[model samples]
Target: MTPLPTTERRPLSDRTFGFLLTLPALVLFGAIVFYPLVGSLTTSLFEQSLVQPGREFVGLDNFRAVLDDQFWPVLWNTLVFTGLGTIAPFLIGFALALALNTRLPGRALLRGAFLFPWVIPGVVVSFAWLWIFNANYGLLNGILFRLGLIAEPVSWLGDPDTAMYAVIVAKTWASFPWIMVMLLAGLQTVPGVLHEAAGMDGAGVLRRFWHVTLPHLRGIIGIVILLEIIWNFQHFDTIYVLTGGGPAGATTTFAVAVYDTAFKGFDLGRAGALGALWLVLLLVLVVVYVRFAEREEQS
Candidate 1:
């Protein structure tokens, strides 16, 4: 057989060197990522206690306990919180992105200000909301009292009816900025000529947006929804700091429940089970996103 050409030899040599260059990073990622993942899975199969020296293998008993107890309610609450939180932020953020994408004055300043909520840490936002929900001297109640909206200050975080809503509002404030930035980036990719062409065809503003802008934004919206779902499902800090899953366990989301079980209740076994359950849910979401992304790629 004829020997390979010099060009082919050089390309193969370069590819080998590139792989060698990336080997360290690949090894580090596996150690940092897969190692913990496998460790967690192994831990989930056993009855472990943070206070104990050894873990007992319990197979599926821990999982069974999780399913039979208040886990169902916590799961339902998590779904509700994630769903509503994701939807509200997407709508509000998309609206804000649309508004800011216009040729309005001081648009840059407004866009920068829009990022303030996202720039603030989740803990800080939670504390701010906690103060706002304070019954006596909170900014919200003070304003309402001054406006004669109520004869007395309302217990925003003290009542089961309003506790979840208060947390949701605070979460929305912190999360909408991410969706706004993503949607704004997507909006910039849309050709202005499409809008001009639609206008020339006598399409109204609403019609143009619906027919032209939305199609271009579909992929970004899908990504935003998926990311929001994942983030909202695992959200703990805001809810923990704001309500501590209080007012009759109204806001006991899965993450909060996991923390309460492991730390407060001292049931590491149950906590591991809860973590495994969330891992399954997150895996399902990942599969869904992968399928959608594959479809988009094919289209």
Candidate 2:
């Protein structure tokens, strides 16, 4: 073969150098992401415990046990947590973002103060909510008592019926600021000229928003929802601190289940299987999100 010119060879060399530059990141990903993933898969195929001397390969037994056990309820609870957590934050945040998008007095201060919940650590927020939900001597009960709304304090977190909701409320408070920031950015990108034109055409505020604002914010909204789903599915710290999967496993999300299995239950095989299941679920969500996002963009 004829030798390539030096100039052509230089381009190839530059491309090779760029690839070489990215090699470190690839190695890091393999070590951090792939290595653990493969390890988890192998662990899932075994009957292993932290206290055991060695792992015993059991094929799909671990997966079958996870599927046939009380995990279904926990899985359902996780779905509920993810759905409510994502929706409540998005709705409240979008509403707040819309209200704040207009020129208003002290808007900057309000926005900054509203973000306090988001900046607080999850454990801190959980403890704060725990205090508020205390059956007696809590702020909520105190206010309700003062207002004569109830004759006695309510056990917000003690009742299985209300525990999940209590946790959801706390999660919502911690998460809404993120959606607020995202929606605020989306609102800013919405063309003011479009709104003005819509108004000139006799479109009302709602009409203008529906016709112009929403369409413009669609991409951002999709991104926010996708991220929320992912984050909410993996949420553990707040639930752990607040409820610890109680007052009777009402708030036991999949992440909490994985934690309990690995640490508390000392079942390495079950934990690894659960972790792999979560990974698969998240991967499916990501794929669906990308597909829907692409469809939205095309439309």
Once fitted onto the true fold, the runs of candidate 1 whose alpha carbons sit more than 4 angstroms away are: 1-17, 20-28
Worst 10 residues of 1 by lDDT: 1-10
Candidate 2: stretches off by over 4 Å: 1-12, 293-299
The most accurate candidate by TM-score is: 2
For model 1 the TM-score comes to: 0.90
Instruction: Give one digit per residue, the lDDT tens place, for model 1 in 214-248.
Output: 99999989988997898899999999999899888
Measured against the true structure, the TM-scores of the candidates, in listed sequence, are: 0.90, 0.90
After superposition on all C-alphas, the RMSD of every candidate to the true structure, in Å, is: 3.6, 3.4
Candidate 1 differs from the real structure by a C-alpha RMSD in angstroms, to one decimal, of 3.6
The lDDT of each candidate is 0.89, 0.90
In model 2, what is the error at residue 85, expressed in angstroms?
0.6
How much RMSD separates candidate 2 from the native structure?
3.4
lDDT, candidate 2, 213-282, per-residue tens: 9989988899899989988988999999998998778888888998899899989899988888888898
Candidate 2 residue 11 Cα shift, in angstroms, is 14
Give the per-residue Cα lDDT of candidate 2 at 236.
92
